[model samples]
Target: MEVVRIGIIGLGNMGSAHAKYLIENKVKGAVLAAVCDARTERLEWAAREFGNGVARFAGIEEMYASGTIDGVIICTPHYGHPAEAVAAFKHGLHVLTEKPAGVYTKQVREMNEAAAAAGKVFGIMYNQRTQPLYKKLRDLIRQGELGEIRRINWIITLWYRSQSYYDSGGWRATWAGEGGGVLINQSPHQLDLWQWVTGMMPKRLRAFCAFGKHRDIEVENEVTAYAEYENGATGVFITSACETPGTNRLEVVGDLGRMVIENDKLTFYRLRQSETEFNRTYKGGFGEPEVWKIDIPVEGQRGQHHLITQDWVNGILHGTPLIAPGEEGLKGLTLSNAMLLSAWTDEWAELPLDEDRFYGLLRQKIEASGAAKTTEEKTLDTTGSY
Candidate 1:
């Protein structure tokens, strides 16, 4: 096939945004064949906006059976992501899901397994991975330019949302609806980038989350999470959707030097010698390794959401590799889950999270909040890996 037919489920903010570009011919080899939503008004809106150019469905089952789309983009709420993707895959459709893959790993793992079984192209909307700045950061770390990483700290509270934003939708900030607040929504990109650049998940984590701290919502609105890596490296992730003029700073320290990314520019403090080597060989007690401040040139513009859609389409049609493969979504999602689990249990959550326990706790939260589960089953009975 020369082109891929893509259907978008969920006519919310991000979903509508994707529909616009795909219909506008922004993606070279992909077209928005159809759109789905649970709300009738959204379907009517789509009809009014796109006319006969795009099909509309009020649910996924009909859209899946309609045979109009080769793939589906799951942009519904967090819980709907995995279930809808799994269904799509079972119907022999490729899947590109929005981030935080699912409310929990157990469900996402199931979705991953379904995609694997179907042998279909699986992609996630981790559009941040397309940023050259982050791409360069990953290269430097992977190439050992930064040596063995020692620490990672990101103050990514730039996605500030007001109470009105949360109040706009019933599912906006509810525990039963959107899952978690900033961690599940606004901060998923940063979380994905945090682990993507470092190429490792935290060995264990302890987190403090402030529920309804800023917004009048039940889920966490502010979070401070600390993590320890298996290689003795440590990381701190701080995020919130309640701060104005917030900061987006990422600092990574390694044996060779320090790198900072803020204001879309990357800066590196290159050390003459490895910090460990200097510490080992220094004859002068008070002397330190000489540092050179360099502004690392980050090239290329962000391809953003449409680029990811095009890439996924290319993967389906031309055997191209996915920039944000759906499976890799588990790493950042694990971080988000562990942080929430830590806060909920008031303890350090370990890597390879106890999926059953986390699911049980999450179910408890939904019960306490009186929110119903959106997945097919109430039990955490699925498993897979990155």
Candidate 2:
């Protein structure tokens, strides 16, 4: 049981949650040694919450300079992710950063390069991958049980964010601030899952997105994308920050059978062999497909971030495998970029995506966007129709 010292660089909702979990869970041998935040009030709150023994700082440099913390969890805003993680990596500290990796792909790439150069463990918090169902699915696919995935459809319309939600943080939807809407923030998990579960990459993509009804800022609130995989399998990805009583159902159809995860419940419809055997075995109509409904038990809803963090820390200390490496963080970011780029250009964008072209587009967007402020004075309503 090797001990690892932990530090956190943000004290907002998610960051505070991670810190509290570190305190409560006693995650393996990890210790919450320090906390940092730029906001004076938040920094004071974190300092008091962590008590006198825990070091506190107003910025990342101070935290790194304090010399007590080994690894740092970066839970900052969308724009700050790359710089913070890169800094931590440069300081030779293992890093765990919240998703989207960056507001743009280039930022993530820089952080990735920094991590590679520094030879430090860089983990991204796509904790949703910790779900047992996904782990099983990954295993099943690896064993060739899925037999080459043919098509996948992910409907992530449940990410509902309101105008007041956007107003809660002035940086919510601006291209320069949060980068993009649903894709950058809420859908990164699903996008990552899309590529992870399918075990593939898109060769080309065409997307349609809508700014729709949000008066808060400029950026997409709804998106629909069609992607062609390198292996010739196709997928449709639909996401929105606007929808009432929306559905989140991920369905994948492979050569073997079809699996569906709806509202956290996983069900697999395993198809029988031949039509004659199916007709002789089944009691349904002549034209009906032969299928067996299989129910998968649900795993408990513990804190995924804590579990992922523990795994990462243990991996660093004891040579265990990482749940999600920092480099993989760029996949979701790249997917988001492709979708947005496709929508912006109203054309199909080829994959093995051109990072430089996308970076240029992002630079133009950032320069065009004037200073936008963000505040936590209000809570974003995670419910609304686009």
Note the Cα lDDT for every prediction shown. Answer: 0.85, 0.78
- Cα RMSD (Å) per model? 3.8, 5.1
Mark the 10 consecutive residues where model 1 has the least summed lDDT.
377-386
Task: State the lDDT of candidate 2 residue by residue for 17-55, as single tens digits.
Answer: 899989885588898998877677876787678787778
Please report the candidate that would top TM-score against the real structure: 1
Task: List model 1 lDDT by residue over 1-386, tens digit each.
Answer: 88889998888888889999987899888888998876778889899989987998866788899999999888776776788788888899999998879888998888888989999999999888889999999998999989999999999988888888776666667777667788988888898999989888888999999999956788998999999999999999999888889999999999999999999899999998999999988898799899999999988877488878888888998998999999988888889999999998999999889999998998777766634443334321221111
Q: After superposition, how far is residue 357 of candidate 2 from its true place, in Å?
A: 1.7
Error of 2 at 323 (Å): 1.0
Model 2 worst lDDT run, 10 consecutive residues: 377-386
Model 1: CA > 4 A from native: 370-386
Q: Pick by lDDT: which candidate is best?
A: 1
